[model samples]
Target: MNKDIIYKDLDSLLNTLNLIQEEQTVIKRKLSGLLDHVVPNHFIDWAEEIHQQILNREVALQLLRKDIIALKKTIVQKKSIIYFVNNQYVKLIIKYKEQIAYLENEFKLWAKVTAEKFDTIVA
Candidate 1:
């Protein structure tokens, strides 16, 4: 009975992770749409490029909000997975830890790059 509960809990957590990942994908599309709409004004100067980006500040802010929310969700999900794998998934052992670590590192790197771009745009 306890084993069944563990498996069910793990399964539910994984499903939640998948859903959040899908949400992240949609957020990415939204952010991409906003970026695509931004055309560079090469006729002017670098200052003009910044000005154009400023014109889209409202959309940028929205993207930032969505990005932050997704990021927080991802972090929480990762921590939950880590805790579960450490405590419950004994059969997976080494494989699960390595896979989970890889997933975390990849996500963190992606988030860092995204944040850098966002900071540049907002600044």
Candidate 2:
């Protein structure tokens, strides 16, 4: 791998990581809003359905977090492989990082929407 290419890829990876972090921040904020609206009175007969939705969201969120961790690991590994030199692998790492961020954001949106629907049903 060319030294110049390695540096360029590293820079691109860093930018992608920053974008992922920004996305994560937005998701956290949305989730927080959903949490704020949770109420016990909303459960009733629909409790079972609401519970299922919550459970599903929990599982999805866990998976998204796991993917984020894996992306971080891949980034670290790619950096090591580059060893301060340019490499072609950086593009693949960036793609995965973007994908992880997208999945995380998608899950967060789903969770938020589910919570809102539950809230409406209970209200």
**Which candidate's lDDT is highest?**
2
Which candidate number maximizes TM-score? Answer: 1
Q: How high is the lDDT of residue 91 in model 1?
A: 44
RMSD of 2: 7.1
Question: Which ranges in model 2 have alpha carbons more than 4 Å from their true place?
Answer: 1-43, 80-123
Question: Please, what is the TM-score per model?
Answer: 0.41, 0.37
Clashes within 3 Å, all models in order: 0, 4
What shift in Å separates residue 77 of candidate 1 from its native position after superposition?
A: 28
| Candidate 2 per-residue C-alpha lDDT over 33-111 given as tens digits, one digit per residue, 9 for 90 to 100 | 5456654544433445544555565565555456545644555565354442344345555655575567557656865
Question: Positional deviation of 35 in candidate 1, in angstroms?
Answer: 2.6
For candidate 2, the 10 contiguous residues with the lowest summed lDDT are 79-88
Pairs clashing within candidate 2: 5-86, 6-85, 6-86, 6-87
Local distance difference test, candidate 1:
0.47
